[model samples]
Target: MSSDPFEIFLVATPGLEAPLAAEAAGLGFEPEIQPGGLTVHGHWPDIWRANLMLRGATRVLVRIGAFRAMHLAQLDKRARKFPWDQFLRPDVAVRVEATSRKSRVYHAGAITQRFERAISEELGAPIAADAPITIKIRIEDDLCTISLDTTGESLHKRGHKQAVAKAPMRETMAAMFLREMGFDGSQPVLDPMCGSGTFVIEAAEMAAGLVAGRARGFAFEQLAGFDVAALTPLRGAEPVTRPATQFFGSDRDAGAVRMSGENAMRAGVADWVRFETRSVADLQRPEGPAGIVIINPPYGARVGNKGPLYGLHAAMGQVLRDRFAGWRVGIVTSEGGLAKATGLPFQPAGPIVAHGGLKVRLWQTGPLGG
Candidate 1:
């Protein structure tokens, strides 16, 4: 990474950029919501911290260099003289990807080829398609900016949750939604229709102050001058002092309950979270203070029949209104009519979020007056 203030872009899942930026800003980083992600200025340690501690970012990129390249010839000339030795080692392999928009250098394949050859020849680094380190170059309006993807795989993998349900929610999206729903981990979180217990597991981890990336490795570990000694502090486990408050989840499927249990165990928060196989109609709040209740129920696009989903939503709403008084509620679904079928007093629907090629929105309710 660069010395003083390198540009770090936190990739957000399109519609959730604002919440990611808010989470970053709350962590004391100066965050600006850009078109696709949140941009922040930070040094090398900040890069490590963002990858290890940030729950909302899908990937982190460090801008290495930028210039104006009118054509391939100019791009090649600048690429040859660029200081490749500063950031990459001779043995490290890299994959290059390029995008061109409204610029004279419009051929993306040729652009990637230039970077690949340059790194291979000048830096003596091999170019492989499956390399952990990737060089991403963007050419827009004759301006070319080069960045390195410091995150290898997506951060949502999180090295836990080996078991997953169909169309499971990404941990990155779940964390941002939790933040949007004012979840600070101080109170209990219940996901009645929890598919794989994403919300409940995430809440327990947050309350335990667990490092998001501790269980996994990052692309930054493959970078030059990546001292394991220097990265030790960032990887050190903070004392997990979870309060008496517990997180809860229940799904009608016994398989889902078992999967949730296995995932929480791998995440090292099984002691703080509880999961059971129970239908929403039989949903009852456990013994504890009233906390947030969030659910990502199927919207007929994927799982259940449209006709029967209305009754399911109505049953969920009835159970919440009857049992979960003083608890905030948020539901993520694609159908507005289904939300209305709940008969719960909901606030305005939130932004439409893109999920698996479909658009979904979050409808929420304040603490129940019932």
Candidate 2:
């Protein structure tokens, strides 16, 4: 909000902080990883770019200002005097959220109320519970940090995939998991159990060099200091390029396969992706070079009891081992027993990624040998 570039926080899925930081660094950002996210210091342009290109971040936050507030009275006094007019406009609505710790102003509701009143009365902005613009307040060790949520919705929404299957994998997690497998988008990707084709479409988009956030509008567009002229170029959608290699996905259920094709069409990667109604046991390698085969198999909760999943996983592993020569594999599942059932040469991946309230780990294999 100030002339000086504010610190940007890129929130990642809790277990995937490292890969997200690596992604930010790959995009030419100097990022420092914190507990739950990565921190980068850059101007507004970087904020726009981070939202547009970085596929792994769940939210992008800008640290507008910080101050010391010991008590509620002192907090109210300082909040009223803060120069909010420079950043907030009277017409735009705002929502304030606060957290307090190790300070006399321990009441989060009071802190939120004070800031809300300050912005409303002093800055003349209407306070709305569902406002697009959000002001976040964190009071730790008596130091209050005020920040803005530039990304209104979670980045995983991606404005595509209007059609989704049960417990679909988020696009953010798909992108990060692909990155974790060292996928630069050049190699072909196949998801045999592709629900809505999340992995395949994401791979197709990446290989075509598409911008991650191109399909959606962001909260920053509604901010007071937003410069339309400056951001216009960045908002331009790049031409969808033809990928040299292709991506593939398949599901046994006719409805899931149909949904995948529909979602792929919506994502503008339908031409580069192929979806088929094929079960995992019947999966075969497509007409492409050696590539990555990733699948998010159903656990006990979704499909049924764990007893049959072992044989299902074993069949998948055997099919891949026998047919898909020289290909690598990534299997995501909550149970290690299921992953081990694959009987592939899987080396342990780094962290247990949490998805849909279930902890899952990615088991990856190097290229297969003759």
Candidate 3:
């Protein structure tokens, strides 16, 4: 609120800090990678831009201020004195969440209550459990770092993907995985087991130069000093030219195909993306230059029995190898053995990423030979 550059944290999916940082850097931000996220120093517009443009960040947090509080009494005293009106609005409700590590104030609930009460009484702001604005308090080694969640829902919600399939991949993870697979949005991308068309739709959006948050509203819009007109330029008025290279997705389930098409339409990428109900064995290379084929297939952990999944993976690998020449492949699965069953010449697997209570990795390959 002071118009000074502050710390902006781009929360990354675990094990994917590098790709997220790369994305941040590509977006003209000087990103410093941390264990689970990256930090960039910037002003309010920078925070707004990050919330709008960053596809890999799960959420963006702006560090408002910090103070050293040894105990609850000191925390309460400082909380009452802290200037909450600068960032938070009295008309908007807020939620306070706190975490304590190796600190005297070890009770997180008490810390949250103290801060909530302080804001409610001092700033005349209402506190609610389901508030759109979130104040994050991290008390580590007795140093309390106060940050605000500028992203209301996780960025993955993207707001347009209303129809979802079983064990669907998050859009944030999908974007980073596409980055990991070296997708630059200029070439064709196909997902044989495209659940809800996440990869295909994301690729199409990237290719069409669509802002990731264009269709969604952010929590930062509710902040005290937010200038709505200032964000208009970031939300460009330039019309999107359809990409020449098409994005494709296929699923054996007709319902999934319909869902994919509906999601793509909602995302405004239907003109550039195609979805169909087809099994992996029936997959044929579309008439075009080869590109990337990526799939988040069942890993037996969630979808179904593991025994038949091996055959499914093998069949998928066979179809790609036999038909989709010159295309690179990336298969995401929880079990290494399932990835191995693909029989594609995969390079060493990428980092183990946390997805839906299971650990998964991307098994990638160079362009397949004839």
Q: Report how far off residue 50 is in candidate 3 (Å).
A: 0.3
Off by over 4 Å in 1: none
TM-score of each: 0.97, 0.97, 0.98
> Cα RMSD (Å) between model 3 and the true structure?
1.1
- What tens-digit string does per-residue lDDT give for candidate 1 at 284-360? 88887888999999889987689999998898888899998999999988899999899999999988888888788
lDDT of 1 at 241: 79
Residue 167 error for model 2, in Å? 1.0
Q: Which segments of model 2 are wrong by more than 4 Å?
A: none
Cα RMSD to the true fold for all candidates: 1.3, 1.3, 1.1
Residue 43 C-alpha lDDT in model 3: 88
How much lDDT does each candidate structure score?
0.89, 0.89, 0.92
lDDT of 3 by residue, 1-370 (tens): 3767999999999988999999999989999989889999998888999999999999999899999999899999999999999989999999999999999999999999999999999999999999999999999999999999999999999989888898999999999999999998888999989989999999999888889999889999999989999998887534366688999999999999999999999888888888989888889898989999999998888966799988888888888999989999998888999989989999999998989889899999999998
* 2 against 3, candidate with superior lDDT: 3
Order the candidates by lDDT, highest first. 3, 1, 2
Among all windows of 10 consecutive residues in model 2, the one with the lowest summed lDDT is 232-241
